[model samples]
Target: MSWQLYEKARGLLSEEFGGIKKSFGGKITIALCYPNTYQIGMSNLGFQKIYYLLNQHDDVLCERVFLPFPKDEFSFKKKNIPLFSLESQTPVHNFDILCLSVTFEADYINILKILNLSHIPLKCKDRSEKHPFVLMGGICATFNPEPLSDFIDIFFIGEGDEAIDEFVDAVRCFSLAINKGKDGFYKRLSTIDGIYIPSAYDVTYKDSGAIEMVLPKNGFPQKIKRRWVKDLNKTPTSSKIITSNTVFGDMFLIEVERGCGKHCRFCLAGYSYRPVRNYSAEVILKEVSEGLRHRKKIGLIGSAICDSPYIDEICDGIAKMGGTISVSSLRLDRLSKKLVDLLSVSGHRTATIAPEAGSERLRRVINKETSDDEILDAVQFMTSAGLTDFKLYFLIGLPTETDDDIDAIINLTKRIKHSILKIAKSKGHLGNITLSVNPFIPKPFTPYQWERMEDTKSLNSKIKMIKSGLKGVSNINIIHELPKWSFVQALLSRGDRRVGELLYKCCELNGDWFKTFRETNINPDFYIYRERDFNEVLPWDHIDSGIRKNYLIKEARKSKEEKTTLPCPEVGECRRCGDLGCVMNI
Candidate 1:
């Protein structure tokens, strides 16, 4: 019975990963821990992409280990069996390396829980050459890593396609050096690109609650250069794809491009992944070729796909290859006639457009500078292109949103729907539109850092106002996200190490979110739904993203006064974001 789970893992693995023995000469055991549930972990395209990559290496053997389900956890507890890899049934402590891939801030607690169950030390200093090398890579570590600094040994920042390939070779070299009686294998690993060893750095806080300095203890680079993969089209993310069950079971996803050209002031991905990198048209066409074989629809992922600069060329390529392509998000300013016409040919009915805010003033405040004319033009273009069903995304509770500003939402939708109805009726085409409204959640490393989220009750009340104004619209569908969930996202996004324990308590209590107030004996409101002084030390202060604090403070003040600030996309070379090293010269 104990080995039943083990045997199933082996059979499934052998069927999918039997060819692993044919890339390296020496045997290497790797445990890929998702640090979340099977359903949650399985859903991640980034996680699965790597799983396929490592298993293809003949010298490297990889297996899956996820945060256990409740029933499986109970079974393990009853038998006193340690957390082990699914493929070889080998305990995690026996593997040479434990690689955790993460996406969100909330998953930090689960990372610790997975480590504890795997018999690994909770602290970085306690682990030595005898145990598995603990490493982490994902968006979280790239931006704000101080909160998880105590636990993770090494962090791989930015894109990992080229970095991970180089990383495996380095790991193999280090292991061989260690076996040959050279003791400094760990230090040697720190010298690689995109790898950050926090233990070698020193952080000092001033009495006034500001970071005095972040210095390296031993010989280390002062500032690490983020890794870059020049041609995304050649070595695109998923060359050999995985087919199985996932959290997003009903959908098939394809990476259209990575990084963003539009530098929305609040976006970290805009700064961290730069130079407007994209996969070539041929690469996108090939991935979609495989996607067409799937039962589900293919999702085109990117910071903004419509602004790919050569989107018409790419969409036309995808259209020539047969498949329904669902894009991540679109900018109204970038939809050209050729692009819209190509979308018509591809048989896409539903699309999403994010204006961010209802009012032009608020839109400009966040550097989302598309005009009302552009939006109406986009609607007309889509109307001509046969796009009837689509969504309009807006953010309520913005830094400077007023009653008139909120009323702009009612007015904007009213105008767009009126045009759609008139255009549809004259042409005898039936078009259905949905307006999705959500509250704004400010995160660290954004220009809105010093700003606070509005209370949930007020946000709901404003939503009610929008609903009342939209009652007269006959054919439009409207959806609003629950403010409470946004509140949880805010809490986790801006929280420190203290809230990590709170996440475990929430998991134990089955996610009664408000219960954090009782369990932690602290007000969740203080950290999330309230404003903070500009002078205080932020929890993410110890980590440097190269953006200055004064710039964020200035932007926050500008937002409050309803003043508009623009990024490079709107103002061109006249604007600079202070993180000059992170931006593209073009």
Candidate 2:
């Protein structure tokens, strides 16, 4: 081990406010790995929450590890030192279990880099009893685990609130009986719900390179259903460590709600995290009161923040504690005056809203359920509440998008900026507006899962058209994501085990995807541009998100017909969307 690297990590740990450290002796040691830089990984509330949850077990001791820094990577390679944990500077291979929290598809290549730098085998089949078992979870794991299935040993199928406890129990039971070999160990884990053991299943491919069938052996469940916490008040899902190293370092974060009731056809979270659940006002007030002791700013995190029944009270309570409040992008329809008033008094200067598409026709196809006039009204309300900085998020290359729709985006943005100026000038102030445009990437388990992604050439042309239309607009900043990177995201989100070969080629080329494609025989376009039929077997069919296939197909047909589906009922009525059972549990 490198003493210099160990001291650097220890120095950072000492500066944190609530970092946990424990002895690994006579305990089931687990390395909680994040495949990103320390600064970025430490900022994630999910990573911090899982670290806190795992350490609560008396028999388990969890430590943190991240991808080595650029200079540290070279130094470790020169010294032949394996990646070590932050708590005690112990090698990762020395731990009994190695669990990963993967949130983004673009980080798939970084996972490969972490394994190679740690001197661990990249493929799960090559690992043995001497190596620590590799487990994966998070949003990326929940929807589709096939792209990296060849590497992950086990995948936690859903939310980590309850799944973490279930996993720790399995670890404890398996460790006590050392005589139980690998087969016995797998069988014991299979008995637990929400755990997917990929090695125990075999996937067959058809002649046309599509999935034929997935067979289970040794009584493994044919379809792995996702697990989630029924009650949000039962657990604490907040940031445990406070340090000024991450992007959100100055703020303490808490999840006010989970799942989205607004079922947008193009959104994966809307379909995957079904049956919206929210933390009660009392629970949120308790967390905010406790969090104020460490930080002055509190970020309310949720996919549907405005949907919470107690959002106004939560925001008001935080203000009483003398803490500034930050929130995720809010829904346009739910942007009430009372909510905006709470935000203005809580020292919020910037507001964000996502109008997903510009034209009403395009919006109906994706089920955004918001009109251009409604978006303008929301902005007027926000500015009236004293917000000086505004952000508008939109997406390009959507299904059924036309050149006129692209022009509508420019016209819509200009109208929004004009409204902001009209409101600002009345208040003796000027405001700035930022436009964030991104390319569309079809994800698995959503209504648009089988939709074909627009090629880079077409996306680039559309992007240029938007830029040209907004050329002379002042106080409006246009920021768009590159088309090339979106292509990479689409491939990873819509690929199978066959994509594993491309990952290896990328590692050898040192993160160069274009060159890797040229050198290898794999055609990236096959995965990105190919549209599938509803009857064909999808890559993620083996893992069920509790949403039935028939419902999604029906929704896709409705999308083509330009019909809109209603949002989830606020009163928690049974809608029979196949997640009705989970809704009943709430």
Candidate 3:
């Protein structure tokens, strides 16, 4: 209703290159909401892809809405203006459906804020036919939707490429049922695979605060199987909207792969997105040719991009088309001179690598498999290819980590710096080595789900140790995430529905989580600092990710013994993880 806010939305729409703006007449309107600022949400490729896919339907008109900037939030509150979509500046509450694309657990509080701003009911049970159905999807929702079950009406699990079509049909059926005053609206949606209606399920907990059982109601499926696009080429995931208002604004992005074959014990992405699939070089080149028309630089996206077999061909095609290429990071063991040289030619001065663990012994515990010698060699190769600066990522509180491993981080970084300096001296240039360190947070469906997170005090001490060890070293920068936030992240990652109450209360206090914990009877440590038994029922047990529980138990045991597992073979029946169906179909 505020003209000032309406003007702001129009200003942003003017800057975008490719965005859908359509008449809402006779259309299934959807407000694609992202619970983050415009700059952060616009940078996400997944969010952009969904918007593109939804608008491709003739009857569907999807618009974008984001959390207001911090300074602008005051005006929104002062003027009592509801949140509006960017394309048409329509009120979000007027849309037929409010689909939330949630990727991080930290943004759970913001979802409540967005709903309150839009004048919508915070709880799903309180919303009626007049209110827009609140649906959610993304990586966080796929693994565990229980924590947000009370708020969302429907959840789309796994990849959204094919699931979106199925959801549209279900929504149509529900709309007809609503007009007839029928009670089977949810039951109609339950028939689709990967569509979870949380209201149709019941969860009971034991006296010890562990989940006892999760039962389905009204003949719903016992387990909701995750759905994924079997073939990567069928769905072309590239940037649909190009604007200079994002993190990687200067480059056009394309997804080269879907999942990682490397089975890292602490990784949720590696386990949840099983049976790794890659986009063919022909498809990638075709995308690059189209993307080059908008931007001169092409950004390749994937879990392990350098491990793709068509890496050289894709880079070569981009080069021949006079387009430079950029990747988020490279695998240490897969680094090649040709790839590094191509990156240098693309005007890239810094190369990023994630060793994850500092010591080789600790790396084995996490199943990283890459040796310290191999990491140093990769750095040497990059420096020789004219890369001056380097960014190294490591986790401080990994399982089985000791003070010796902390010392190893310092020693390994210094060795990498020495390697770079030896090459830089000949070129008369000195480059800085940056280290990004963070505390480890266990995620659901991973081998570390049952493990306890290190206490904040000990994690702080380890961070201080790393800082003190490298204090006097020049041209070496250390940037570590706050330990307290990691504690909050861990609690949310492994929490049940009870934690959602705390999340709502925390939002009411304007994001003061510490005060919320003190006021509530819930013990945050019960979710963060406690290890679980193998027989316990997890909050996400009813959500089938196709990876068996027994396989995760076996992997957890292997982690304790400091054993390493080989990466998934390119094409074979891998029965090790009980994901043979996914592997064989690939």
* lDDT, candidate 2, 246-331, per-residue tens: 88888889988888877899999887788788888899889899889888888889898888888878877876778787887879
C-alpha lDDT of candidate 2 relative to the true structure: 0.86
Considering TM-score, where higher is better, how would the candidates rank from best to worst? 3, 2, 1
Q: Write the per-residue lDDT of candidate 1 for residues 82-174, one digit (tens) a residue.
A: 788765577998888898888876577678777777878877778876778787877777766665667777777666665766778877786
lDDT of 3 by residue, 421-531 (tens): 999778777878999999999888898889999999999999999999999988999999999999998888898888889888898899999999999999999999999
Q: Which residue pairs show backbone clashes in model 3? A: none
True lDDT of residue 272, candidate 2: 75
- Candidate 2 lDDT for residue 459: 93
Point out the higher-scoring one by lDDT: 1 or 3.
3
Q: Show the colliding residue pairs in model 2.
A: none
Hey, what RMSD does candidate 1 come out at?
4.3
Q: Which window of 10 residues has the lowest lDDT sum in candidate 2? A: 577-586
The global C-alpha lDDT for each of the candidates, from Candidate 1 onward, is 0.70, 0.86, 0.88
- Those runs of model 3 whose alpha carbons end farther than 4 Å from true positions after fitting are 178-183, 583-586
Ranking by lDDT: 3, 2, 1
Better of 2 and 3 by lDDT: 3
